[model samples]
Target: MPHLTIVANITAKADKVELVKNELLKLVQPSLKDAGCINYVLHQDNVNPTLFMFYENWQTRELWQEHMNTSHVKALNEATEGAIEHVSLQEMTGIE
Candidate 1:
């Protein structure tokens, strides 16, 4: 099966930017250790500090879904409640 690519765009409430970022950062090391993870990288918008993005590559769609279902991810959801302005997730394939 082909690898899966995910683009996760997160926009935080002005006052909650740092909180959101810290929570998101906590996911990195654990996420990278997942069985199917290829590379999980985070980025912050240079011009817009409240904008955070993730570039994740997984071995399969199922594994990516598993990543989302993890306990830490669930906690993250709870921790960031009402602190996020927007979230956009895109599942992608490599054409080249």
Candidate 2:
């Protein structure tokens, strides 16, 4: 089966960009350690500091779903409540 790819975009409230970014950064290390995680990279938009994106690859869709339910993810949700403007997530399979 092809690996699962996730593209997640996060936009922070104008006043809460740093807070949201910090919270998002906390997810990287832990997410990289998760089972079946191939790569978990975070990127910030050069033109728009308020925009952040995560490019992730996992061994399978199920493992990626498991990662989403982790404590750290829950903590991120709690910590950034009302601080985020919008979030968009997409799951894809590489076309190899």
List, residue by residue over 8-89, the lDDT tens digit for candidate 1. 9999999999999999999999999988999999999999999999999999999999999998899999999999999999
Q: Name the lDDT value of residue 72 in candidate 2.
A: 92
Model 2: lDDT equals 0.97
Query: Tens digit of lDDT per residue, candidate 2, span 12-50?
Result: 999999999999999999999999999999999999999
lDDT score for residue 47 of model 1 = 98
- List residue ranges in candidate 2 displaced over 4 A: none
Which candidate's lDDT is highest?
2
- Please tell me which predicted candidate would have the highest TM-score against the true structure: 2
How many clashes show up in model 1?
A: 0
Residue pair clashes in candidate 1: none
Question: On a 0 to 1 TM-score scale, where does candidate 2 land against the true structure?
Answer: 0.98
Q: How well does candidate 1 match the true structure in TM-score terms?
A: 0.97
